[model samples]
Structure formats: C-alpha cells, structure tokens
Target: MMEPTAAVPADGSTARRIAPSRGPETARIARGTGKQWRLFNAALSHTPDFAYVFDLDGRFLYVNRALLELWRKPFAEAVGRDFFELGYPPELAARLQRQIAEVVATRGQVRDQTPFTDPDGTTRHYEYIFVPVLAEDGTVEAVAGSTRDITDRLRGEEELRTAAAALSRSNLELERFAAVASHDLQEPLRMVAGFLTLLEERCAGQLGADARSYIGRAMTGTTRMQALIANLLAYARLGEVGEAVAVDLGETFAAAIDNLTSRIAETRGTVTADALPTVRGDATRLLQLLQNLIGNALKFRAAMRPPVVHVSAERDGTGWVLAVRDNGIGIAPAHQERIFGAFQRAFTSGTYDGSGLGLAICKKIAESNGGWIRVASQEGTGTVFTVHLPALE
Candidate 1:
C-alpha cells in the first residue's frame, strides 16, 4: 500500500488525502505519473457528481469530495473500504460489487440506477456508470465510476403520469354522459317532430299564414337541435370505437360516393378520383371521414357552377396524403383553424345546412389514427382538405 498523498486543489483551497490501494500495479497508477493525479483530483473534486475509483478486489482506491460528503465520512473511514464495509445495505452493496466485477472482467462499461438514503436522511435516486480503467498495455487496471442524482427527473416523470391518468378518467366520464343524454333526448325530439307534422296537415285550412309560419320555424329549430345532439354524441364516443386495421382507401371512397349518389344527382355534381392507397385505420371511421369531407364539398358549392369534387392520394414519406379538392365557395383563412373545432362554422345555418361537426369529426379521426388533417383555401376560389394517414405496415 502506498501512503496517502495530499490532493492539489485547483482553487488553492485546503488539501485532502487520497489513499492508493495495496498492490504494486494499482499503487503505481495512483501515485500519479507526474501531475496526472493532481489534475484528476482537481477536475473531479468540486464536481456535483460523485466520482470514485475501485481496485480489482472492489476496494475503494480513491473517492472525490462529492462522494465523501454524500457518505458523511472522512478519508480514513471510506478510502480503504468496499461498499459492504461502508455500511451499505446487503442487497445494494452486492449488486454494486457485481457491476464493478463485470466492468473489470469485460473491460467495458456498466450502467444502472438505484435509490439511496443519505446520512442526512434524504433519499435520492442515482444513475451511475462503471467503466474499466486500462493501463498502457491495454490491460484493465481498475474500475472508475461516476454517479449522478436523478431524483428530480424521476419525480417529474411520475407527476406527469398521474396527471395524464386523471385527465383520461375525466374524458371517459364526460363521453359516457354525452352518449346517454343524446340517446334520451332523441325520443322527445322525434315526438315533437311528429306532432308538428300532424298539426301542419290537420290545421292547413284553419290556420292563418302567420300561425303556419311560426309552426314551420318551430319545426326547423327542433330538426336542427336533433342533428346537433346526434353530432355531439358521435364526437364524444369517438374513443369507444373498435381498434384500427388495414383499410382500402379506394373502397371507402367508392362507398362514400355511392351513399351520396342521390345528392350528387340532385345538384348535377361530378365526383372523380384517382387510385387511392391502403392505410392503417378503422374502416368505418375512414368512411365517415371521407363522407363528411365530400358532403361538405357538395353542400358548399358555388351558386354559378355545379360542384366539382376530386379525390386523390400521394405518398408522404412512410405515410399517405389524401386530398379532397372542390370547386365550392371556399373558406376564409381566418376560419380555417376554427372549422376543425366542434360547433364552429364559417357560415350560418341559413347559408349552409350543416351541424358544424363534420370537419371536427374528420380531425378527430385523423388524429386518433396517428395522423392529421389540414385545410387550404381562398374564399370565392375553392378549398382543399388534405388528410395524412399512416401507410399499412
């Protein structure tokens, strides 16, 4: 064993003794080949991280000031000791010894984390790495280790997880309430609609023009209310749908056009499409997404021309971008982002007959499938809605 030598402080402060282990090989390195020991001690002594060196036998050969402060011990007590002799718990000490042995045996690095309670009774999480210290001949002479306190980082991660769980529960409860309320309200709305129709038929000759007009307005209000409620329920229950799978975009596009065949014929609109790609998502939701976009294109057509809606697809990296372009009364830039929010519309119900949940539903469906939707338009020219979806893996 070499005698403990005083460390040269970089800041001209009081010196501390660093002991070298009992062995010709390790003692020679620890004695400092010229000024190497002094430089090493000075660089690591004041660092916040705990730095130390261990011999092949897992005995402490050197420990920096930070480590000594953590243990709340002097050089005399900790320098010549292993983890077990320093009063570390049996399990922790054994694990650390094994890591140190592995580093020496493999001549490589070992990384791990553990929780430790300091002498001051404050428990902290630590991430540490052990690496072999090789001699000039490429032989493993010792194992050098560094440790950092990661308690704050771990605490932050746990807090984020707790907040996310709380938010998820709240959303689930809200969705359930909306679905139940929507279902209950439908029967009453149907009854009101039915009664209005009967009143209009039976009292057609007796009622005056003003009285009939009031009844017509009432019926329209009830119809709009029913549509709003249905859309709200669909929005809330988006998460309750089945899991996603590979779906053929071509089939979904064809189905949407077929469903809108009557409306297409009534407006003399033209719907065309190029070959679409397969995507990873719920087929039902994808169909709904297409229907909503295409429906909006048809509903918001320019007064001077028949609706011209074209659907196309192109590759976007590992994903696919599906575009629905229409020659309709385009949206203003200010309303582009707002249109994706529930109950938001660029135009009033009188101008466009819609529940205002179509684009919002499209946005939700795209996001739920690890994709997104965006819009570009110049009011009075036309509008383009592009939906990015993941390619089937």
Candidate 2:
C-alpha cells in the first residue's frame, strides 16, 4: 500500500488530498469518492442561499458558489480564510466568530440577522443560522452555516410601519379637531336657544300663530344641534379612553338597563336578557354600547305594538357573540351598512329622535376592543345587532 500524499495545485499550493495508489482497486475507490464530492459541490454551488462550513478554529473550510460571489473572492482565497481575513467588519466578524464558537461549544444552532454592504455599495439585510456538525462520537466536528438575503422583507416591513404611523397621526389630528370644534359650538348654541325661548315668552300675546311657530321651530333646531354637538364630543373622545380590562358583560348590561329604566317604562318596552359572558373590554364603553343598542330598540318602536328587546350571548369559538334583538321598525337593507358611519341615520330626524352617533360609537367601541358589531334586519320586521367579543382569558 502507498501512503496518501498531498496534491499540489496549479499555483504550487499544497492541498489536503490522497495520493494515487498503485492498485487499480484503490484508484477506482479514489475516482468514486471524487465523483461524489463533485456531485455534492455541484448541488450546493447552484443554490441562491450562501452555504459554508467552518472549522473548529473559525476558519472557512468550504464556501459555496453563492458565498464566493457575495465575497467577490475566488474559492482558493476564501476557503482557507476566516471572516476577519476576508474583510468583514471587525465587530461583525467578532460577533460571527462568537456565534460560531457558541454552536461548537453547545453543539447547537445559533441564528442572527445583520446588515452588510456589498462591494457595489448596496447595503442589504441577511439572516443566517450556524449549526454544529457532529461526529460519530457525538463530538462537535465543524460548524455549517446558511445565510439568506432578507433585505426585501425588511424593507416591506419598514414601509408598513411608516404607513401605520402616518395613519395614526392623521386620526389623532382629526379627533382633536372634532373635539375642539364641538366644544366651542356648544356655548353659542345654548345662548341662541335661551334667547329664543325668552323672545317667545315676551312676544306671546302680540305675536301671531305663525310667529310663535317660527320661534318654536328655531328652539327645536337649536336643541337638536346641541344634542348633535354633545354626541360629536363623545365620539371624538372614544380615542382618548383608557385601556381595556376584564369587564363583566352582565354588569354593564344591567347598568345600561337601569340608566334607561324611565324611558323603557315610558315607551311600554320590555327588555330581557340571558346569561352574559366576561369579556376583555372597557366597562364604560361596553355599557355605552349596550345603552345605544337597547335605547335604539326602544326609541324605534312600531306604533302598532310595544317594543320587545332581547339580549343574549352564545359561544363563538374562544369568544362570545352578544346579540341584541328587537321587535321594532327594522332598518332597510340599503341603510344598514350606511348607518354605522358618523352622523349617518336610516330614518329622518323628524321621525327618529336621535343624533345618529349611537351605532357609530358602538362600532368604534367594538373595534377598539378587538371585536366587531354587525346588524341583520328586514325593512318592516325587526333588527338583530350582534357583537363579537373575545372572552377574558
């Protein structure tokens, strides 16, 4: 048998290799091993991801074609060099060396992300993982690594963050404007209503029926305007409310019913409920939501019969679906979706006494609590408002 010898490259550089033996059997085995090595190299060389193997000393033992291209160095130059010798930044090289050492010491994987500038001056992000290669004895032999370019993914995420920040600022500005405008208008509206009432009282005997009617209409207009302004302020302040907490829907429902007790009696309306669930939400907002829905049911009753509103909850996966069903003048299909928008009303103010912010506020509360509210109705029958809220964990 002949001893294995080092193969010399074209540059006269000594390389680790096995010298050809005299026997044909040894030569056949060497050829088969070389063919397998070629096949393995070819497969790795074609992949877009950078693949490499590092010796225990943090020196590169092998680098795939993608890595060679990234480094802009030939195989001979990169294969024997470490990160520092290959011109990686000192800090980055040190970090990589430490991670490689960790993988070797723990016999586990280490993953990280980093930014690198190419020779062409284009900086890109990369995510890489280093894993230990184990020998038959369960000892760390070497560290193998793969790096993927994540620049596009990171760029997309940054863009989305920028858009979200812009939207948040815009919403804040709009809410502030609404609050200021509604607050400033209220005092003047009150003054106008007060003066109109005084003028009607003073001129009662002298004025004709038409004059009194005009004054009465003017007072009514101002009253409705005041209500609208108040509702606007409330809606604007929704964004300024405190964070959500665990709230018992049953308690909020009871409170809402208690608040509307007088109106319920006046309208001859009956409000009933089933067992309610505990939800993750603000108690005040949840109470307001119930008040709005139940109040609407009472207010929009058909003249032919007294109102009947039923509140119930059922399990929906890990959450609960709260339903407020009412036998009243149901909304038209065309107007159901529109009514959720700010100041949108399905019926005229003359027929329905409301500022039209009730459903809109309910919708906002639902969304802020990571839930949603929807309505189902036929024109003449009744309406069902369903709110889906997550259960408190």
Candidate 3:
C-alpha cells in the first residue's frame, strides 16, 4: 500500500529536505514550509493506484511511477505528454477530455468507470477520480486524477448479473415444469385413489391377488412420478451461474474426471481426451456439463463389457468442439434430438432412474455460452454427444 501524503502548495512551500533554498530561513519557517509539499509529491508518487495531475488543457503536468508501469511505457514517455497523444483509445481520450472540461466548467469533481482495450490488447476495467483544482480567481486550473484498476470487481459483478438472470429464467422454467407435472399426475392420482376405494368396497366379498397387485403398481408409479418431479426441481437448480472466464478446458476436464474417479475405478472404465481449447464460459456450468455426459457413460453400460469412454476436443473454426463417446447402448437416430429435451427419455424408467433433466441442463448451458449439443449413435454400437463452445475472441 502507498502511504498517504499531505498536499503541497503550488510554490512547493511544505518541504525543504529535497532542496533547501539558502536565500532565507524564516521565509520557510513562517508556519511550516516547502518541505511538506515536496514530501506530499514524493509520497503520492509511490502509491499503488495511478495518479496524475493534468492542466485545464489536458496536458499531463505530472504522473506517478505506478501510472507509467501500468501502461508498460516509459516514465519519460508518459510525462509531459498530452492525454490525447497517449496510447489510449481515441474515443476514451476524448471522453476523458470532456470529463475534465465538465469539472473545469462546474468547478467540481467527477467520478466515472470505463473498460478499455489496453495497448497490449487486453480489456481492462478502471475506476477514476477526477478532482478539479481552482485558480486564484476561483476558476478551475487543473485536475488531479486517481485511477483504480477494477478488473476482478467488474468480472464478479458480471457473474452476479448472470446468476440473477439464470435464476430468474430457471424459476420461470420450474414453475412451468411444476404445472405440467401436476397436470399430468392429477388424473392418474385420482384414478388410483378411485380404484383403491373400489377395491375396498369390493374386498369385503371378492377382491383377488391380481387386483391387489394392480393397485400396488398404480400406487408405486404415482410415488415414483412424485419423486421424479421433486428431483427435477433440484436438478434444474444444481449449478448457479458463475463468473465467466477464459478457462483451459483441458484442466477443467481433468478436474471433472477426478470428481468421478471412484465411479471410473468401479466400472474399470478408461477415459481419454484430446487437448480441449480455452473458452469464455461459466466454470460451474462447464463442470455440470462434463459431469452429466461422463456420468451417463458410466451409468449406462453393456452387460458383457466394462464401460470405456473417450473424450476429445479440437478447434472448430470460430468455436471449440468436444465429444464424449462411450461403449453404451446408444440411441436410435430418430430419438437423438428428443433425448436432449426435458422429460423425454428413450430408455425405460427402471433401467435408468433419472429425472431426465441432465441433457436439458447441458443444452441450456451450451446455448447460454453461444454453443449447442449434438449426438451421433447406433443402437448397439455406441453414442457420442458433441458440445461446441464459441471461442472468447
């Protein structure tokens, strides 16, 4: 942290340690001296944040070392240069000039935040403070500005915004799903309840074992449907939308596969991958996406063979393409697209006990990141689900 410095007078009348004037002693001794001013400048320059003093004409009167280091430019290059002449974008420079003019006209400070592409071509967000300096006639003379780099803060705010949006959408989707589940169950539940009553009415004289078994199956199906709906809600809200970043997909996949290590070991499944490219994506969503695809490969397997899953990725023009192929019972071509939708399953419920929201969630995450999921399969051969994510650039 940079130590705070007290301000100095324009005539440098606060400190004499750097350069003491031999012309007079009490001239500097009248209620303190230029030593303080020199100390203030010396202190402010060492601060972490960028600080500079610019005249009303937008010429940099002084800049701290931090400012020069941040731009990766020479101190001599930044000092004594007009703000317009700096490597900053033309529009941003113009906006800064306008802001300085605003402070000069109003004789007050102005604060603003903006993101800019730096000289090295990386986008950075900065928060600025512009303080107006008044002249002897009470007119604005210069502006003292302090800038704080806020790249992390902006990214967190964006992640929060994304979560709020996804939460809103998920809430609406859950409501619709709840309504559908209720609507589908109401009649079946009523029919079961009615038949149980009918069996009770007739059992005193003549209910058979067949009737009892039929009633039991009916009750069981309804109970499973209720559980499925509850599970669906949990599945929909599994992963919260998170900060999007340029993540190395290879590392992400490794972490995800590690999470499934126990299952992979139990099934003796061999998992392999190609180099996955980096992408601007939500980390949590990507994890969930991998979990679902890899989990399915493990969950559904052939009776005679241990599961073997191959994961591979490559650049596909403007996007990255990844595939999870497994030696499991595959879907028929006609049912491939339907498998990705909510509550639409080609497999029997007993064979795979799932709410069937995994692929649906994957689809949403992919589309949200400007991508999509696709499939290729044959019934006894195998299945390959491919995910495509657009490159950040």
Judged by lDDT, which candidate is best? 1
In model 3, the runs with Cα more than 4 Å from the true position are 1-231, 238-240
| Predictions in order: lDDT | 0.88, 0.86, 0.77
Clashes of 1: 0
Off by over 4 Å in 2: 1-47
lDDT of 2 by residue, 352-387 (tens): 777889899999989888899999998668999999
- What lDDT does model 3 reach? 0.77
TM-score per prediction, in order, is 0.83, 0.86, 0.45
RMSD of 1: 4.7
Q: Between candidates 1 and 3, name the one with more favorable lDDT.
A: 1
In model 1, the runs with Cα more than 4 Å from the true position are 1-32, 106-109, 134-139, 204-212, 239-244, 391-393
Best by TM-score: 2
lDDT of 1 by residue, 1-393 (tens): 345443333332333443646677766565554356667788898899998888888888788888888888876677668999999999999999999999888999999999999988899999999999999999899899999999999999999999989878888998989988988998899899999999999989999999899999999989999999989989987875567899999999999999999999998999999999999998999999999999899999999999999999999998999999999999988888799998799998487777888899999999988899999998998999999999997
With a 3 Å backbone cut-off (N, CA, C), the pairs that clash in candidate 2 are none
Give the Å error, residue 312, model 2.
Answer: 1.6
